[model samples]
Target: MKTRRVFLQRAGISAVALAMPTLNPLLAMTKSADPLKNYAQTLRVAIMGLGSYGTRVAEAIQSCTRTKLVGVISGTPSKVVEWREKYGIPEKNCYNYENFDAIKDNPDIDAVYVITPNALHKDQVIRVAKAGKHAICEKPMAVNAADGQAMVDACKEAGVHLLIGYRMHFEPNTLEVVRMRKEGELGEIRFFQGLSGFVIGDPTQWRLDPELSGGGAMMDIGIYSINGARYMVGEEPIWVTAQEVKTDPVKFKEGVDETITFQLGFPSGAVASCLSTYNMNYLDRFYLNGSKGWAEMQPSTGYGPIKGTTHKGPLTEPIVTHQTVQMDEMAAIIFDGKEAEVPVNGAEGVKDMKIIDAIFKAIKTGGKVDLTFG
Candidate 1:
């Protein structure tokens, strides 16, 4: 196995291809055309963390006919001021961590997308919910299942929608594969393999910190494999067994996993083998084999034109930028009552977290851990 020295842990920013800039169909919206007249409704969003992924999403939202970036919530004054000048956000629409609660009174902002560190997601999303603004948070959703559930419950009580950032759930090629499986084109699913990882670069980065990151590679890139297995196999895992590997403990540190190999058994008798790591390269792949046919995506979960092939032929779905389609689809889901081909709601997020909790337990016990989802 090849090990790398650095990782792009930023959300929706790195995967495989510039990490390929996902190829997406450009919307009808243009600077010359008015979006209000073209689209039925619009979702005005404020991003909480001004990180690389947040900037990427903000850039994509510029082209969305139904989604608009109208505000920002950041702890750094420089980033806030930078976003204001660059995105043309108004002074009144700006907010910091301590004052974002005032958004409840500001009707102009429709939602807040929490892109903060892993451990911060629960509190930030709950606060966004309590403020009556819809909350869209980047995954895992939280550090653990309990925190994930708390965010979900808080949003439910606040009567606001809670959306987890599952960009691949809206990807064209991924959905094409899903459609094939759902329509019985893939036959009885039997196996799945997902490999996701990259090297860790800066040991001092927040991602390497136990408090902010909650964990290591598994908490970051590993999620792609876990989520992919469930969707590709069309079943949630009933049991999981995992083993951990650590190299250069000085960098990985305590509570931070270096690499992990895991197995998942589903109710349908299908099984999946997956690997998540922060110490390897040339990973990013997803494969599924069923009784009748099979599908494979090499650069599966990356940021591009996702490339894939199956027993039938190559997957040639219309390529759309990952973040662009995600934001547009999210707007439709929030405003037009449209359901996604794949779930991206809070419950979906919690299920992943529960499975992750089980994986960690299995690692500690060196035995299979059974999983049950509600």
Candidate 2:
């Protein structure tokens, strides 16, 4: 087994407050939050989805030193029973989907982890924010950019933090890539290629439903490429153009895309080509070409054991549970207000959603779509 280091414990102040003596000025401001009176207390969390990803998140939280899964929101009573038995949660900590808003009065859960389907994210996040709890929503943030904006506004107005689950932002290898890029290791990056996809097995799965998933592979799996494009270049995209193809209309209904190949032009003159699809297998990879040398990550965006190499050499870091580290950092940010190396808040997520929206539009119009983010 590889040795792992948890960065959250080294934070000087309560994770909610980033004004430690060692923090840089820029970091202090972005991570600033009121110091919790109970800085040493455990931050309680509610797992809203009992699906595969939600189950995995619950398991990962068990290893967290500063967070606890104290509540749940599930549509299935059987899952509630199983979770209560597995996690030692009481019945009061369990809630059905319809009555979950009453969690405001429970006082046990400090935050709600919205891990449900893509379309359900908006309403659930709003309810969590309205209930005066912080929200940590899964990626794509919402079905559309407008809904994404609404979730951000709701959380900001409620004075609760809104975090998106971009686990790679906190992963060691991924961070190393960001650091190397910033340090000029790749030397003036000019082009990038991001490939993210997986073969869909079940035709009847929610991921195929336009209403439930918002879109097909682009919404479900292609987001990795969208996010990869921005972080790899360290700049926002300014324009986009794309094309979509669907060989099976029965499996991929109207409003659901099967595969999309898109290009992004950044303000810094960097251009990126990306592919997102559900018909391919083991396709997660990212490559960057710069004036001097290049960097590439194979199995870049998959769930763990990420591998990468640059012109200098391959990544030497060992693989760790990305979710475990992510949850720990989120706890520090939520309760102690610690600043992440990069922002993982709703704003960051909205920027990516904006790009995804533009990609779809560009595909539909067969013309370039310009984008701007504030």
Candidate 3:
């Protein structure tokens, strides 16, 4: 399959060729003189779900330089009204799930950000693609690798972009660490330890439901460790071995994992030891070790102000809102055709899903599971 950047480049060439013959000399000259003028235009975005994370994302987008929250899609009528009034969304832009397909006719919306439950991502992303809009789906992207690939295919077929909401990919502290590792500051990377978890409050929440969440702590918080391992090591894992433990069987039922410790083996003989749990609090941290030096971050994946230190000194990157920077950078990706420093596309999401699939398989069989992204 052609990559998104290749597809965009090809499309851009064809578009330029098709428009050149019809362009008036004066208009062409004007366009050439200020090519960046139109590039600075705002990207109008519509948000789906309107849940807690969705609300946070909407608020964050308000701080974006080249993005606007112009529309909304929600199941509840009251939320639609509340969002419309608060965000200054028009009535025409507000839509229910059943009627959101009509967004194909609404030119005001450039993209739809799917911030709904994990299980709903596949269908909602495909629907967004079919509506002639770009898609920005929240992580974990989908319930499984197959679903994630389906969303990618749907967006590709529609000639639109599909971005996964990996906000940390745009985070300053995280990126600085990644940059250092890539610059060989970490030497030949050998090991990584990622501990990501949070205590669950409500047993009756949808996240506890296997059908809605796909899994338990692994699916929600554990994925951060999985993704961080991949990016921090800068390589695809060849195999995974995992073990699951549940202390509270009453709260975490069958198919819903409470705590999981997974290990990934890379082709370069590097290994990652990670833990994902729902019963633990303040477990967010990432540690990377290499032949020469090391880097560590505590409260790494938290909402804001991620702090870290390297073998040399402190990692002092400017702190910014993760979602806000993400939206601004996404505007560049969607409109200006800019490439992300760390990929956050559907393909990236699919790779993570593939790893997650392997981890689950490893846990189920109590053996090492070989991973193949293709």
Candidate 3: give the clashing pairs: none
Worst 10 residues of 3 by lDDT: 22-31
Which regions of candidate 2 are displaced past 4 Å? 1-39
Ranking by TM-score: 1, 3, 2
lDDT of 3 by residue, 1-374 (tens): 34655755743434443332221112212323334243335678999998999999998876665678999999999999899889899999999989999999998998999988899999999999988899999999999999999999999898889999999998888999999999998899999999999999989998999999999998899999999999999999999999999999999999899999999999999999999999999999999999989999997999978999999899988877888788877876765566787899899999999999988999889999998866
Q: Under the 3 Å rule for N, CA and C atoms, how many clashes does model 3 have?
A: 0
RMSD of each: 9.6, 7.0, 6.0
Q: lDDT tens digits, residues 1-374, model 2?
A: 01112223432234444443322221211212332222365668999999999999998777665567999999999999999999999899899989999998988888999999999999999999898888999998998899999999998787778999999888778888888889998889899999988889899999899899989999978898888888989998999999998898898889888999999999989999999998888789999988887889998988878999988899877676777778767876765556787779999989988988898888878999999999
What local distance difference test score does each model get? 0.87, 0.84, 0.87
lDDT of 3 at 52: 94
Off by over 4 Å in 1: 1-32
- How much does candidate 2 score in TM-score? 0.90
User: TM-scores of the models, in the given order?
Assistant: 0.92, 0.90, 0.91
